[model samples]
Each structure stands twice: as C-alpha cells, then as structure tokens.
Target chain A: MTRLAGRIGRFAWEIALPIVVLSYWWLATADGDNPFFPPASRVLEAFWSNWFDERFVSDFLPSMARLGASYLLAVGIGVGAGLLLRLWRPLGEIVEPLISFLRSIPSAALLPFAVLLFGIGTNMQVFLITFVCVWPILLNTMDGVADTDPTMLDTARAFRIGHRRRLTRVVLMAAAPRIASGMRVSLSVAVVVMLISEMFASTNGIGYVTIQAQRTFAFADMWSGILMLGLLGYLLNLLFVRAERLVLSWYYASKGR
Target chain B: MAPLLSVEGIGKIYGEGRSAYRAIDSVTFDVNESEIVTVVGPSGCGKTTLLKCISGLLPPTDGRSVLNGIPVTEPPEGLGIVFQDYSRSLYPWMSVAHNVAFPLAGKGIPRNEINDRVERTLAAVGLRGQQRKKPFQLSGGMQQRVAIARALAYQPKVLLMDEPFASVDAQTRAELEDTVVALRAEFNVTVLFITHDIDEAVYMADRIVVLTPPPTTVSEIVEVSLPFPRDQIGTKELAEFVKLRSHVYRAVKNRWDDRQPGQ
Candidate 1:
C-alpha cells in the first residue's frame, strides 16, 4: 500500500510542472483573441474537431502506415547489410566512398530526387524515411560486429560450430547491444523523417493535414497538429524502448543493470 | 594405438624481417589417447602461442601439428578449447544450458541426445541443475566450470585448455584441477593443458613439458608417475610430487634466469 501511495505521489510530482505551465498559458491568453497564438482551450477544441473524426482515419492512419512500413524496411536492410559489410572487409571497402556520399547528403534534400524518381506516392515517402533511418543502424552494427570479443570467436571456432550458426547466433547476438542502441536512435529519426516526407510529397497524411492547416491560417488546427506530432513521437519512442527491453533482456540481466 | 595428438616442431614468427619477432622456434610433443599432458613455462614464453598453434587457432610459420591422424592446419574436429578468459568466451546472452548446447547445433545431433550430453557434461563439471543461470550470475570458479562443461559436452577427442584455471582463487583452482583429472577418467579424452603454475602442471599432468623463454622451445618434458584421483592435500604432500614439482620448477626457472638482462 505504501508503494502504491509512493507511486501516485511520484506521478503527481512529475505532472506538476506541466500542469502549472498549462494553467499559466490559459491565464495569459484568457482574452484569447490572437491569430498566431490560440488559447490552449481553443487548441484542444480544434484537436477534437479536426482529429476526432474522418481526418483521423484518412490522415492519421496513412501517416502511421507509412511510418510502420519504412521503419521495418530500414531495420531489416540495415542489419543485413551491416553484417555482410563487416564480415567481408573487401566488400566494405569497395562501398565505403559510396556509403559516405549517400550518408553525407541530408535525406530530406533528396526529396526532390525521390519525387522525380518515384513521384509523391507512398513509395517516394517511404524511400526518404528509410534512407534517413538506415544509416544509424548500419554504422553502429559495423562497429559492434568488428569489435566482438576475440575469445568468443576463438571458442566458437574451436568447438566446430558451422559458419552460418557462428555468424547468425554468435556474432549477431554479440553485437546486439550496439545494434539496439543504433535502432533507438533511428526510431526517432524514423519519426522525424516520416513527417518530412509527408510534408513534402504526401497527399493524405497527418503531416499534410498540419501543413494544410498552416497554409489556410487555421491557427488552432495547426497548433493541434503540432501537439499531435509531439504526442506521436513520444508514443513511438516509448514503444521502441519496450521492444528493446524484450529483445535485449539477457544483455541487461547479465550486466545486472 | 597411435598418439592422439602430435605437436611436431611447430613454430610461429610475428611480422616480417627488420621488425620480426620469433615467438616460438620449435615446440614438439605428443599426447596419447586419454592421457593428460601439461605445458608450463615462464610468463611470455609463447606458451599461449604454442597452444594456439597446436589447436590450429593460429597458423605456425614452420612445421605442423597432427591431431587424430589429420594435419591440423585449421581448428580440427574432435577438439575443444577452454580459454583462460572464461567470462568473455562464454556467451553472456546464452543461459548456461544454451552455452553448452551451442556448439552441438550444427553437429546434426538429435535434440534428446544433445540435451542428455549437455546435462551429463555439466554434472561432470559439478555444475548440474544450474543450467538456467547465466555465466555472469556464477562466481569465477563456477563460470570456469561452465566453460569446462561446454568443452566436455562436445565429447572432443582432445581438449586444449589454455591456462583455464589461472583466473580463479587457489581453493577453486585446486577443485577444478581435480575435476579435470576426474573427468579425464570418465570421458577418456586426450588433454593438452597449458599453465604457468608448476604445482598445477605436476598435479594434473601425466607428463610436464617445460619451455624456455622467447624464441621459445621445449626445454624439458618430465613424466609425473603420481596415481590418479590424486588428492589436493595427500597427493600434493607426497614425496614424488614434491621432487617432480621441483625438477620442472628448476627447468622453467633456469630458462627464465638465462633470459634476464642483468643475470
């Protein structure tokens, strides 16, 4: 019972500052006649009117779909390519300059190229998000794979484990902590790139709705979209952390951290 | 009837001319089936290099080692190695049972047989029923036992132990030494053990191979005629055990002194 009461107290303390800031915003804008700065109440009202209906299905679902597909694609390709490149030194060297060149250019800047090639479809949007997100996973995987404890490799080899099992079961798991760290970084990148891709090439997503609200000067609607973006980013990170905890449970347990 | 492992004139050199370093000049020995042999040398006498060469982990620049009638150019089948650094060698991601079973995955053994072998091997190392725990959860001594269990589960024709008990406390080290001796009787596996401890070499080996320091070569090989199931207290206190220990100790110390700059 004390533990439960303590948890409640902690939760209230965590929300205290946010609630105070919210109240201050309400008091400061009580007159609520500004075009640029909508009162928190008006923003909440617009959030309901804009998002709690058809736009939720037409706009929000599409944004989430694109984010989901591109993020999965990036993680899969990143891990596969990372393993192959690290395992084979020559192959990694041959593509070193090409990877550098691609990584150097902001993936958002390639939006024009993406649109020209795949044309503002879901394909173009996905290409941009995946391109941006994959770099972190791939680079971190390379470092981790390269730095696997040599004694572990020696032990596996001495035991006559097959090449395939050694690579997948031994090498991959050894590199997982670094790979997971990179993945966490990319999850945030996936969220940001999802918005950028939608703002540029998307015809029907939350990013599109937000941009549309801004263009027509629906200030309350735009504020609501911004709030939703923050909410969604926070939610996606929470989900990623949960997934990370599950996959790397042994890692944490072994370290007793 | 033939020797199970023959480390015949194996040698290793690091780098090329001008900056060259000769780590092992020529190391030669033989271990017959089910026999235990220990190699003891002063620190940095290429004891590790010699073991790596024989186990086929590192390529010897000169000569070759033959294991079970096959020339060991690479890590051969029918061999298991337990490195001294037990913590790093055992996969932390794996449970103790999984770590033991990992090498058997590609051996095409049936599931039931593999489980049985894993359990039996763990029991041999005195780690039975602790299979669900991770390696880090165990003490250093227990962790090395898990490593030993992992090796013994493979049922290798030969087991190469590279100073495996060097990191454990003295009491645990003594227990592990006896465990290996006892397991040899059970498993009938040929063993090539490496160590810097003279007492360990005398206690655990049927024969002791002492090495001279760098450009390292076998200085002497002394046979230990002590009886099996040797006790830590009784066997170590035996007159024959002390004489053999001193003989190997003098051989190792003599070479160590020869290599000293101001001696």
Candidate 2:
C-alpha cells in the first residue's frame, strides 16, 4: 500500500503542470473575449468532431508517414556520414566547415527552396524534415565517436582484436550513450520540421488542416489542431526518453554510480 | 638451451638533433625459458623504456630485440603485457570473461576451447564466479586479477609487466604478488617484469636487473637465491631476502646519483 501511494505520488508530480495549464485555459477562456484563445471545452469538442472525421484521417496519417520516412532517412544518412567523418580525419577536416555552415542556416528558412526543388509533394516534406533532423544526429555521432576512450582502443590492440571487430565491439559500444542523446534531440527536430514543412507547402497534413481552419475562421478547429500537434510532440519526446532508458540502462546505471 | 628472449645492445633515443633525449643507452638483457627476470630502477631511469623495446611496443633507436630467434618488428606473438593502470588496461564494456578470452580470439582457437581456457585462467586467478561482471564493477585488485587472467589466457611464452601493483593497497599488492608467484610456478612462462620498488623486485624475481638513470644501462643483476612457495611475511623476513633488497636499493640509489644534473 505504501509503494502504491508512492507510485501515485510520482504520477501526480508528472501530470501536475499539464493539469494546471488546462485549468487556467478553462478559467481564462470561459468568457470568450479573446480571439486567439479558445476555452478547453470548445477545443475538446472541436477535437472530437475532427478526430472522427474521415477527411481528418487522411491529413493526420500522411503527416505521420512523412515524419517516419524522414526520421529514418536522417538517422541512416546521418549515422553513416558520422562514421565516415570519424574514421577519416582528412575528410572530416575538409567537410567540417561546410557542415557547420549548413547547420547554422535556420531549417525553417529552407522551406521555400525545398518547395521549389521537390514541388510541394510528400518528397518535399520528407526532404525538409530530413534536412532539419540530420544535423544534430550527425554532429552528436561524430562527437561520440571522437570521444571514445583511447585506452579502450589500446586494450583492443593489446588483445590483438582486428580493426573491424574493435570498432564494432569497443568504439561503437562506448559511443552508444552519446548517440542515444543525439537521437533524442533529432526526434524532436524531426517532428518540428514535419509540421513546418506542412505549414509551408504541403496539401495534406495536420499543418494543412490547421492552415485551412485558420483561413476559414474556424477558430475552435484551429485551436484543436494546435493542441493535437503539441500533444503529438510531447508524446514523441516521451517515447524517445523511454526508449533511451530501456536501451541504455547500463550506461545510466554506470553513470549514476 | 638458448634464452627464450634476447635483447642485444638495445638503445632508445626520443626526438633528434639538439632536442634528442636518450632513454636507454646500449642496454642488454635476456630471459631464459621459464625464468622470471625483473628490471628495477629509480624513477625516470628508462626501465620501462627497456621493457617497451623488448615487448616490441616501441622500437629501440639503435639496437635489435629478438624473441624465439626472430627480430621483433611489432608486438610479437606469444608475448602479453599487463600495465599498471587496471582502469585503462581493460575495456570497460567487455565482461571479465570476454576480456580474458580477447587475446586468444586471433589464434583461431575453437569457441569451446576459448571458453574453457578463459574459465580455467579466471579460476587460476581466483575470479571464477565473476565472469559476467564488467571491469568497472570489480575492485581495483579484482580488476588487476582480470588483467592477469587475460595475459595468462593468452598462454604466452613471455609476459611483460610494467609496475603492475604500484597503484594497489599494500594488502592487495601482497596478494597479487603471491598470485604472480603461483602463476609463474604453474605456467613456467618467462617474465620481464619492470618496477621501481626494490623489495618487490627482489621478492618476485629469479634475477633482478638494476638499471642506471637516464641514458640508462644495466647497473647490476642480483640473483634471488631464496626458496619458492614464498609467503610475504616469511620470505621478506629471510636474511638473504633482506640482503638482496638492500643491495638492489643501493644500486638504484647510485644510478640516481650518477644521473644527477652535475654528474
């Protein structure tokens, strides 16, 4: 019974902020004077109506599909590039400046160029999302690989372990915690880029629904779409954190001690 | 029979021209098959440089080191090394068993044979039940034992150690010293152990080679005539052990004086 109460206390601690925010929104927007702010009940009603509509399914699924595709692509290409940069010093030196310059350019600013290049299809959305997400993963992975302990490398050498096996067994295993951190950062970036790309050019996606509702003066629907996007982002982040905890339990335990 | 390993007029100089620093100057030593040879010296006297040259980890500037009649061009096969820092010497990600099994993986040993050898070697080091524990999980002494197990599992003809117990507590160091003595007796493997501690050198070595300071050379070689199955208290209290320890201590002190700035 004590353990159960402790768990409930922990649950309350986690949800406290969200509950307070919801309560404030209900209280503040009850008189409906503000054009920008909708009451919690009206937003909930709008959410239920749109959530069950068949047309809304098409937009939401396509946006999620695009996010998945872009995130996977970014991870694959970014990790591959990171490995290349780490293994080859001269190549890394040559490309590092260019990669830094590219990363400095705001990702949202690339939407216009992305639309011109990919012509406002699913491809454009994916390209933009990949562009925004790849930098964090690539930089983090390279840093991770570079920071792998030299002593461990020497240990591998003393044992006569070959280069390929050494890299796989020692270097990568040592770099895992850093790489997980990078992936978590990239996941949030992927979601942000997904919505931004849809807002800028896409005909189908949650962003498009939001844009349509705003243009049509459907204030409650617009608020509902915004709330859904925020919820989706929060859920994605939570999922990444959970996965990181599961996969890197050893790293966490070792670091904690 | 010829010595199991030989080093002839080995010299190592770091850098070149005006900046040149001579570490070992024409030093020579050899280890007979199944013999334990310890090199003792004061700090900065190039005893470690000599061991590095012999182990083929670093090439001597002007001389050759041969193992089994072949000149060592790289870290030669059938030779293993245990460094002082146990934290740096073992891969943290690998289990103790895997760390022990590491060196043998290249010899094309069957998987079962590798497991058998790792288990046997860990048992020899008194770490049998801790196979799955990572190196970081173990105590410093236990980690060093894992290092010893790794070197032993390699089944090397020659093992080189660089002040392997300098960092451990006195009690743990004594225990590890006994473990080495027992291992040397069981395996009959040649050892080229390097240390700055004269007492440790005298206690563990069959023959202790004392080195002179920088631009170092062999100053003396003291044969330990003490009997085997040695205990720390009993062996250290022996009259001969005390005499030899003092002799090594003096030799190393003289070298330090010789390498003094004005000398």
Candidate 3:
C-alpha cells in the first residue's frame, strides 16, 4: 500500500508541470485572436473528428511505417559502423572526422539534396530520418564499447574466451545501457526528421496533410495534425524508456541507488 | 620431475628513457604440482607485476617463465587468475553460473556437462544455491567466491591470485581463507597466491616468498609444512604456526627497515 501511494505521488509529480502548461495554454488561447494560437477546445474537437476519419488513418499509418523502417535501419547501420570503428582504431581515426562533419549539418538542410537524389517521395523521408538518427547511436555505442573495463577484458582474455563470445557476452552487455540512452535520443531525431521531410516535399503523410490544411486555412485541421504529431513523439519516447528499463534492470538494481 | 611452473630470473622494466621504471627486478620462483606458493610484500613492491608475469598477462623484460615446458607468451589455456578486486574481476551482467561456465563454452563441452561443471564448482565454493544471482547482487565475499568458482571451473593447471581476500571484512576474509585451503586440497591445483598480510600468507601457503620494496626482488622463501585438512582454530594455536607467523612478520619488518635511506 505504501509502494502504491509512493507511485501515485510520483505520477502526480510528473504530470504537474504539463498540467500547468496546458491550463495556461487554454487561458491564453480562449479568445482565439492570434492566428498561431488556436483555442484548446477547438483543437481537441478537430482531433476527435479527424483522428477517426479514414483520410487521417491512411496518412498516419504511412508516416508511422516510414518512421519505423528508417529508425530500425539507422540503429542497425549505426551500431554496425560503431562496432567496426571500435574493433579497428586506425579506421576509427580516418572516418571519425568525416562522421562528425556530416553530423554537424542540420539534417533538414539536406532535404533538397535528398529530393535530387531519391526524388520527393517516401525514400527521401526515410533517407533523411536515417541520416539524422544515426549519429547519436553511433557515437554512444562507440563510447560504450571503448569504455569497457580493461580489468574485465583481461579477465575475459585470461579465460581464453574467443573473440566472438567476448563481444557477445562482455562487450555488448557492458555497452547496452549507454547504447539504450543513445537510442532514446535518436528516436526523437527520427520523428523530427520524418515530419520535416514530409513537410519539405511530399503529396502524402501527416506533415503533408498538416501543410495542406494550413494552406487552405483549415486552422482546426492543422491544429489536429500538429497535436497528433506531438502525441506520436511522446508515445515513442515512452516506449523507448520502457524498453530501456526492461533491458537495463540489472544495471540499476545492482548499484542499489 | 621439473616443477609445474618456473620463473627464471624474471625482470620487468616498464616504459623507456626518462619515464622508465623497473617494476620487478630479478624475481625468481617456482611452484611444484599441487603446491601453494604465496608471495607477500608491502604495497608497490611489484607483487602484482610478478603475478602478471607468471600468468602471462605481462611478459618479463629480461627472463622467461615456463609452464609445463612451454614458455609463457599469452595467458595460457589452463591457467586461471583471481584478481584482488572481486567487483571488477567478475562480469557484472552475467549470472554467477554463466560467469563460471563462460570459460568452458567453446571447448566442445556439451550443454548439460557445462551446467553440471558450473553447479559442481559453485557447490564446492559453498555457493550452490546462488547460481542464478548476478555478481553485483552478492556480498563482497560472495563475489570473491564466485570469482574463485569461475577460476576453478576452468580446471587450470595453475591458479594465480593477486591479494584475493584483501577487500572483504575480517570475518569474511577468514572464511574465504578457509575456503581457499579447502579448494586447494579438493582440486590438487597448483596455487600461486599473493597477499600483504603476514598471517594470511603463512595460513594459506605451502611456501611463502617475501619480496623487498621496489625495484622489488624476492627476499626469502619460507616453507609451511602444516598438515592437510587444517582447521583455523586448532592451526592458529599450534606452536609451529606461531613460530612461522612471527618469522614472516619479522622478515617483512626487516625489509621495511632496510628500505629506508641510510638504514
């Protein structure tokens, strides 16, 4: 019962800031005089009507599909590249500067180039999302792998554990927490890039629907689309956090902190 | 027959030029099959450096260490090491059983055989019921026992320990010392144990090698002819045990005296 009460307390603590912000937003937008700030109730009404409609479902599913494919692809490729760099230091030195330079430019800035190369379609959005999300995962994985305790490595070596087993048992386990943290950051990047690419050049997707609504002065529809995107981002972050907790329970529990 | 392991005039000087320092200088020792050899010395006396050389973690600068007629190059297949810090020695993410069975995985051993070996080893270490627990979940002494079990399960020809019991509380340390004595007899494994405690050195070793301060060198080798299946309470009360303990204590004290400038 005490644990339940503590959890309830924590839940209330977490929602307090968001509740205050939402109340302020409702009060500020009551008159709906500002073009940018629509009334909160109007936004909610728009969301309810558009959310269940077939048009919204079609665009939402495609956007979600694109986001999922791009994010998974980025994780696979980024982790692979980071492991390769860790295994070979000379290769890491040669490519590190190039990776940093590429990561420095805003991913949205590459939309025109992406359009030129892959055309303004799902491919362009997928490519941009993958590009933007890869950096954090790659860098974090590299740091995690490199940071494996030398004593543990020596212990592994002394036991004559082979390279493959060592990587799987020791290296990957040690790196999981750091890599999970990186994936959380990368997921947000993936969602943002997905929306940006759709907004830049696309005949479909939630971003395209949002842009079309605004252009046609369908303010309520635009507000609904933006609301949906915000919800999607929040839901994705929560999922990643849940996954991290499941995988890294041992790490946190061991410290007893 | 030759000893199971031999270190001949082994010396290690790290780095070069102005940064160079000799960590171990002209240190030599040997361990007969089924014998327990303990190396005791003050801090920074290159005791750990000597163990590293014997276990093939670090190559000697001037001389060679041979194990079963082969020159020690890398960490040998049948050699196990238990470091001082138990927390760092065992992989934290793996369960105790998995950590123990890790060394036997690719050696053509069957799954059931691996499980049996891990269980038996954990049982031998008095940790039979805690196989599923991760190393971090255990107490410090328990973690050290898991480390020992991991090493023992490897069935190494020689077990090299670097101050394995230094981190635990006094009571746990005594129990672990008893555990090591039991393990030595049970396995008939050649043990090269290192410690800073005089009494522990005399208690756990068949022979004790005392080392001087850095640039460290072996000062004396004391033989402990205590009978097997030794009990801590009775053994500590023996006249022979008292004499040997005092001798080692004085030898260490003398080394400390000699180390001071103009002594």
Best by TM-score: 1
Q: Which candidate has the highest DockQ of all?
A: 1
> Which candidate do you rate higher for TM-score, 2 or 3?
3
DockQ of each: 0.84, 0.44, 0.77
**Candidate 2, residues B143-169: lDDT per residue as tens digits?**
999999999888889988889999999
Which tens-of-lDDT digit does each residue in A1-257 have in candidate 3? Answer: 99999999999978997999889989999999987778999988888887767865678788989999999998998888888999999999999999999999898789889999999898888889999899999999999999998889889888988999999888888888888888999999988888888887987888888988999888988999998999999998998888777788888877784
Model 3 pairs in collision: none
Q: Give me the runs in candidate 3 sitting further than 4 Å from their true place.
A: A1-7, A13-42
- 10 residues in a row with least lDDT, candidate 1 chain B: B100-109
Off by over 4 Å in 2: A1-11, A48-57, B46-49
Estimate, for each residue in B114-209, the C-alpha lDDT of model 1 and write its tens digit.
999999999988887899998999999999999899888888999999999999999999999999999999998888999999999999999988
Model 3 Cα displacement at B202 (Å)? 0.6
Can you tell me which runs of candidate 1 are displaced by over 4 Å? A1-12
* Candidate 3, position B69, lDDT: 90
Q: List the residue pairs that clash in candidate 1.
A: none
Best candidate (score: lDDT): 1
TM-score of each: 0.96, 0.91, 0.94
- In the order shown, what is each candidate's alpha-carbon RMSD? 2.1, 2.9, 2.2
